[model samples]
Target: MKKNYVVMDGNTAAAYSAYAFTEVAAIYPITPSSPMAEKVDEWSAKGKKNLFGSTVDVIQMQSEAGAAGTCHGSLQAGALTTTFTSSQGLMLMIPAMYAMGGQFLPSVMHIASRVVTSNHHSIFGDHTDFMTCRMTGYAMLMSSCPQEAMDLAAVAHLSAISGRYAFMHCFDGFRTSHEMQRIEALDYEDLRGLVDQEALQAFRRQSLNPEHPTNRGNNVNPDIYFQCKEGANVKANSLPDTVQHYMDEINKLTGRDYKLFNYYGAPDAEEVIVVMCSASETVKETVDYLNAQGRKVGMVQIHLYRPFSVSHFAAAIPATCKRIAVLDRNKETGSVGEPVYLDVVTALNQAGRGDIRVVGGRYGLSSKDTTPGQIVAVYDNLEKDEPKNNFTIGINDDVTFTSLDYKEIELPHPGQISCKLWGLGGDGTVGANKNAISTIGFVGGKYAQAYFSYDTMKSGGLTQSHLRFGDEPIRSTYLVSSADFVACHAPTYVSKYDLTEDLKEGGTFLLNCPWT
Candidate 1:
């Protein structure tokens, strides 16, 4: 007895989770993830059938490197392939993502992430095309909205068909792919019983067979080609414990708690921030309004970014965290930093915590606007004892500078909730706030979050949706400093800006004006 549904964004929950277990997708389109390959080509031109019923071969390529060479020849012809893109079409699928991770090929790409134009051209949202596909070995994850982008795109297509490896499953393009909400529609018999049906039938009984003839794309002529590329890097580092045992069996059938990096504020917090996509729901509402004013602050977010756990991010940074920032929406010009602040300073110097200081910044990127008073000015410059070393957030650097001053703070309201939208640039108000965050995460069961701010020249661009519906699991991050409800679909931006500063004192403002 479970029938709840509602979707409208995060590109229709990534084309309804790639029309569930897609047999072959391979699409190509850009901008805020080209309406998820135009809703999987209008649900494969209205045929729509999955849950093992089949009928999903939506092809249509000719770009994003010919949809990553038709998802590497439809996963070497055995099928179960997928695709969708963003930002320079995920940088033109980096050499077919290093030949689908040197032939481990288990495919999954979805990625609404945008903003990879550099110094100018932008389509919004950012992470520089999934941080330039972390060395192209694939396995990146990130998602902060649209029911964790349809339960992590069904846990990266059931852990890429039982851990063969190749996934990207991102989010945050036009704020969770055109915002819309109301969820609880994933249980195609519990995602076809979380894959591994005898290891996807022994990977289709070891494919590429013409009555069992082998030999695939080989050319290793360097005497055991570096021992077959270090045995394909020990099978891509044992696929992060086979993707954490299918993310602990889908967190024991959806009790919600996916790991590979997922901690949020206050559990013995001191001052943490590290981030990932969808602006970690505005830094979890500023870590529930600075832990309701007591202020210890905490946050981690980051979901499996190319197997970079480092002991699960140094055991979710606690040992009385002594100030860290990391942020990064992508910008790595002269290197030494950028990939999530050099993997949180190499996982806090390999956990020795080297007196934990860490600092690295650059924010919102092509999509700009990172508010909550610029995350309370990066937690007031980590309560400065001598802060500045490397920073920039939201902008205004006094004519050619490092940026850091946007201060005018006055935020603290844990039970805070806000919503604001001023449509125009393709007015769907980010697809009706991703359908109100899947109807407040399925009829207000709560723990729903959304944050969006656009307008860096994308034609009449000016959008904002920063929502929060509580009952635990919120953890404030940034933007919507105090809202509580504010919607204004362009009544000329309530006479140009200051749309009631940070509301709260009595909150609730919804304006789509017409009373001319």
Candidate 2:
């Protein structure tokens, strides 16, 4: 099958990848994640045939919990089932997720992972929601951006079908989920060829059949309950290899190497940042810039998190990495450190890396800005003799006094053209930006990216659109702080939001208004 490229957001990418293989999708609409389910529903409505030569059965549930319950039922009845959710919607699915995992039902839950109503019920990007589901026995796969969101999402489905553990494939909520990017897609035939036919057939044979019915989710006493629960450890421990095997197979097909942890930087980097999600892309750009300047710095991007292999993580780190900063997108207060930080500490401890100093910091809660400058601050902290035990970035934390000082540095993206659009919800601003990106990316042969942000409720709510395209693959994940073009489609928003706050010198500003 020939490869094709399209300009699309993370949600659309996930939908397309899953739609190719899925037999059933239990859907519930939630901000930043609704588009994924909507895409599946629309396609199913249009009678889109999956590789199985049948249109996927999309069932819209009353709630997220209903979606999860239905997903479990579908998987039990021998169907490849999935769902898309985030934040509170995800929390509602926990009980069913446990049942599905406990029963060893293979399913995939595509999450545009978001902050779960912390400071406020923010419908924004973060790992706080994903962090809470770490112990659910699901194979948690993290994708840094839309492309990986598409690639690893397929990996998740493949892994689930082959392995006993279900999968939760996640990325930054609005940053990646709503952000559009041009990417070379995996051909459906190529992806289909990678699925283990024997494993899938065996799974189908094991499904619930009236001809050979069996009782699951039964009440068990302490007698054999512990043994039955601990019995899954063998399969659970084997997930790392299972995930890596598919990643390797994908690399062979695509010529792109993907592993549990991918390292990018100078060969002998003394300082490094270990992170995941879209921020890894931003950090990679920082690493590339710093490496050219003779700085021995690098980054380790974590893709497989649940069954994190300490050996693989240790192997990925440069032997010369003396100081490392683990950036946590979600803050787990009252713990030793944030989720990933603790995991990194445990991994390093297991690998006997006592010589390397590892510190943790928090950033990007509820979609707060996490720029390259903030990442540079993380590296600077690594250079310190005694860096702040736990620091914050992209904010002034005067109360805790744990904020890192960083000089705002300009990102050097070649042939980059950034644009900003301001409009109200349902005003077609987001739609227009999507079309603009598609035109530039598919026709102009330029790499393109776009992201939209707006509150769910609010009359005449303001929506911010960030669009960028260039000759090279665009990596900056955060919103456009500075743009070459700015447009305001809603005249009333002029007094409410700063439209040209980040416009560059000689930048074009277009305002839509009545000629009074």
Distance from true location, Cα of 261 in model 1, Å: 16
Q: Assess the local accuracy of residue 444 in candidate 2 as a C-alpha lDDT between 0 and 100.
A: 96
Cα TM-score per model: 0.34, 0.97
Error of 1 at 62 (Å): 33
- Please state every model's RMSD to the true fold in angstroms: 19.2, 1.6
In model 1, the runs with Cα more than 4 Å from the true position are: 1-8, 12-38, 46-55, 58-77, 83-103, 109-138, 141-165, 172-206, 213-230, 234-273, 280-304, 307-323, 326-374, 384-516
Q: In TM-score terms, which candidate is top?
A: 2
The per-residue C-alpha lDDT of model 1 at residue 494 equals: 70
* Per-residue lDDT of candidate 1, residues 226-298 (tens digit): 7887777777677777777777776777667888788898988878888987788778777877788899889
